[model samples]
Target: MAHANDAELYAQWLELLGWLDAEASARGLSFEKVADFPDYIYRMERPYDLPTTVMSVGVNSAGQPLMIAGVSPRHAQLKGVSLRLMGGSKHWHLHAGTRGLLEGKRPFTRERLAQLLDGAVRGQA
Candidate 1:
């Protein structure tokens, strides 16, 4: 697929947010969209040490998540939406049709995001 334009990227971000919301709702978790940043924060309750789950849309060096790098195909191919593990610094990339952060799972839909979130909340992957 071609690299998505900023508008398209933003649309995808919104779609991902919708998925995350549905997932969080199902799990009785809290999901909030961060206006200042192209990210969402999921708050986990007690008994779980992970107080917050921050999932940020992967942005380019310009700090624009909605940008499609015109100069680097590398960035286009490798970049996508991403989420980090709670209390961990590394981020895992999420491609629409490929296996994502969770082993053997693809985040091709919003439901998958929720599934990944569930796994994350359960301390899996």
Candidate 2:
């Protein structure tokens, strides 16, 4: 982890998103609809919430903090680095993953991200 800060942050974002999804599920909240953007994400809000939340999470690229969720031709902008949607660029991968999780669980968190990375490495989560 050359850039431990960014890597750690990326993992944390993933975990937080996971937690968010789980919490939302227990409350019987489901956001099956995705945002207008193709990114991996889904808007969520309480029954009487003021506004829907747009949550985006993913791996952070080196130099750039943008995370790549699903697939995008502009991935090269990160120069082949792993990144999530932290910067201005909307890394659809994060959006997609988050959107899916939001419908299932809550938002991802730091602990969850570590587990996810470990699972990914071991070929199991």
Candidate 3:
């Protein structure tokens, strides 16, 4: 069961990486993998208002990787974003046009992520 879960998580992460790569290129943003961890950072191509968003993939007790994306503003701790990737799914946990945390989940897409990235760099999310 654990092996199966690990394989599934790997597949999901691969898909997510592919989506991120394409999205970053298409949007003229920058994406990079962290050197010391299973993490990735996506940022603006040049001067931008938004902060860099880090996608940290941590291993759970079952050896499955869970991805949580958030912004780490200068002189601030990491803060949660509106979207996350877990259990082979993308979830939106924020209200539209607002950064307020909300209950329930919504489908996560690359377009939604693009908005989140924008918000992050602008220090709004």
Using lDDT as the measure, the top candidate is 1
Candidate 1, pairs of clashing residues: none
TM-score of each: 0.50, 0.27, 0.39
Q: How much is 58 displaced in model 3, in angstroms?
A: 15
Clashes of each: 0, 33, 4
Q: In lDDT terms, how accurate is model 3?
A: 0.39
Q: How high is the CA lDDT of each candidate model?
A: 0.42, 0.33, 0.39
Q: Look at candidate 3 and give me any clashing residue pairs.
A: 49-121, 50-121, 50-122, 51-121
- Give the runs in model 2 whose Cα sits over 4 Å from its true position: 1-4, 31-125
Give per-residue CA lDDT, model 2, range 20-57, as digits (tens): 45543443433122222223233244242212232332
Candidate 1 per-residue lDDT over residues 58-86, each given as its tens digit: 22222322111111122254445556554
Backbone clash total, candidate 2: 33
Instruction: Please identify which of the two predictions, 1 or 2, would achieve the higher TM-score against the true structure.
Output: 1
Model 1 bad stretches (over 4 Å): 35-79, 95-107
